[model samples]
Target: MSKPALLVTAADLAPQALALLQDFEIVYAGKTPQPADIVALARRHDPVAIIVRYGQVNAEAMDAAPSLKVISKHGSGIDTIDKVAAAARGIEVKAAVGANAAAVAEQAMALLLACAKSVVKLNDRMHHGHWDKATHKSVELAGRTVGVVGLGAIGRRFARIAAAMEMRVIGFDPFAKDLPDHVRPVDLATLWSEADVISLHCPLTEENRNLLNAQTLSQCKRGVIVVNTGRGGLIDEAALLAALESGQVGMAGLDAFAQEPTPANHPFFGHPQLVLSPHIGGVTSDAYVNMGIAAANNVLAVVGKAVAA
Candidate 1:
């Protein structure tokens, strides 16, 4: 049998992850492929399948590759890919879900802890020998109420950690099925009204974008801390900024943003009450390897074995 052809458009996979594709006739590109270029490459190569991450796949990209049978994603979020277009042409779509769940969950906790204790502020103060500890008051997590705004793998894991810390944990997930004994299922309104801290862990769907706006922020308890480890569009930065400025929100820890490589003057750049990260929730070495291998294995399963549902 001839070697199968595969196109890997997402180039951030680690070296170990790249080495796993030794069996395929792989064509790699670091950025989103241009329509004309992808068309010519697909026509010339006649690839069996293509794997992409964080790239748009519209009707044009799909129609150009008649030989393409499957489209595998390196990450859990498939919102970037046009699934409707792919299905209209009979191309199977698969994603490596739950692969980076643990990494994201842990990072959320890291952010929450950092915010609760004012970790960054104190460290910066101490480094300058200003000893501003007199004015800084660190909050404790022990008896606070924490609300998780999604019950997927990442959200559930984060809830478990919060429960272990003796915090009152409540969750809101429309699709929630199996929840632990400690986590009580509640409506979004209840979660917001009661939680001392609220963490967002939902996808960037049309209905969910800007879920945390002025109206929703008004429902929360005063001096609430906010954390976002999932998609950035779920929260409105403008509303968050206003709340932060007015002291309605005590602090925020954000690992993702509306735009990556967030501009230097972005509202969050020097916000004293905010801990901003450059979408590094899943950037750990272990997460890189796991997601990479999972993405590569998904390709093999779909193109070589017709596996992966």
Candidate 2:
């Protein structure tokens, strides 16, 4: 039998994943391709499987490639892929979740601390010779109440760290049947009302999109710090801006944005209390390799008619 053929989107294919391709041929694309473009490309390979990242896999893409059997995501968050489309075509969709839990959790902590210490403000003041240390205010993490949304792998990891810091941890997850001993389960409203800090770790879904809108935010304690290492659409950007303006929310640490590379003139670009990272919550070197390898291995396993963790 000939080697199983594969199509991969713009990502460095790891050697471990490459090794699995020993029995398969591989095709590569630099970035997401349009519907017609993907069809034309698929004609050349007639690949058995296609792997993509945050790219649409609409009916057109599948209809163009009759031989396609599986669609695999390079990381967690299936919000980008059209799972319904894949399923209708009898194509399997698999994601590499928990592959970078540690990386995301660690970055969340880094942002939380930065917000608590007002690190960016202090650093900028010192750079400009303001010597405003006396006016600078910072809070300790130990005695704060941290509300964690979505008690999944990353959320649990973050909660663990918060507990270690002596912070009272509250969690909310509709799917959670049982939670860790350290985290106290609470309703969404209670979490918003009681938490001194709130961290979002949920996925982006229709029911959850803009979950932290104005109404929900109004229930938060004044000066509540917010962090989101999850999805950008989970919070309402416009509402968040208003809250920041009125001091309803003291600070925000964002690793992901509604739009990537956020437009140059965006309001968040120069916001003092806002600490923004380039959606790199899961971009650690270790995470890169692990997720890459797992995605690749999953492709191989799914191609062979099996499931991979």
Candidate 3:
């Protein structure tokens, strides 16, 4: 007898993860999959489960797969999946929460350091045979304060690292129960006003979308450094641009953007103080395997099965 099909919304999965799903026939959706492409593939495959790695799974795609039982996210964020639609259809939606936390937190740490030290700018000057060792003075991190938004796994990990640097770490997360001793919890207003460096580690929710806008930016201390390894929607790009130009935000290191694979004409491109990456914070090799295993487990559990030992 033929096995039921399982779909992965990426070109590939970890070999270890795939080995555990031997009971099903796995199908792949190419990278950079569009909504229409996902819908078409779902309709044609009628997969029992889907592991979303790199695409948005909307109501249309869910409806296309009649036999779908679970929509499993490859990483922590489930904003790309339509949870309400899945619930209405009696389909389970699961996220591999915290599987990539350490990897992302490491990236955040690097960005914060880069922003504080003007690492990229200095490197550029050196390449052009310019020496500004006497003129350039970078911000010292020790004893400085950093307000971390969202004290989840990733946020907590970052807090630990910041604390190691002898910096004060204050965080804001109403739902976080396991507060570390080093990370003091504070309100949003307090975080904005007091933090020398502000790092965003929150998810994109209707309530927190554009949480860092012109109004909030104005509340922050002058020349506050900003680091975002979280969702792009958490910031209003226009407001940030103005802040950058006005010297309100001294520097910003952003991994995620409002638009993925940002267009060539994006205004953030040419800004020296704004360091941008292609959102590969969680793309480390270790995180890749961990997230894949977690996602596979989520799919199997929702389907009334257990991953092979």
Which residue segments of model 2 deviate by more than 4 Å? Answer: 31-40, 305-309
lDDT winner: 3
lDDT of 3 by residue, 1-309 (tens): 677889899999998799778888899999888888899999999999999999799999999999999999999888899999999999999988899999999999899889999899999999999999899999999999999999888999999999999999999999999798999999999999999999999989999999999999999999999999999999999999999999999999999999987999999998999988888999999999999999988888977463232
Q: Candidate 1, TM-score vs. the true structure?
A: 0.90
User: Weakest 10 consecutive residues, lDDT, candidate 3?
Assistant: 300-309
Best by TM-score: 3
Q: By descending lDDT, how would the candidates be arranged?
A: 3, 2, 1
Candidate 1 CA-lDDT value: 0.83
lDDT of 1 by residue, 57-155 (tens): 666777777778888877777766678898988888887777788899999999999999999988898898887756867899999999999888889
lDDT of 3 at 303: 79
Cα-based RMSD of candidate 1: 2.8
Q: Tens digits of per-residue lDDT for model 2 on 1-309?
A: 566567776645767767766666777765545556566667777777887753466777777778888888877877766788889989888888899899999999999999999888888878988887567668998989999999888999999999999999999998976788999999999999999999999988999999988999999999899999999999899999999988999999999888766888888888887999988898888887778777877777767653221
Off by over 4 Å in 1: 12-20, 31-46, 306-309
Clashes of 1: 0
CA lDDT of each prediction against the hidden true structure: 0.83, 0.84, 0.93
The full ranking of all candidates by TM-score, starting with the best, is 3, 2, 1
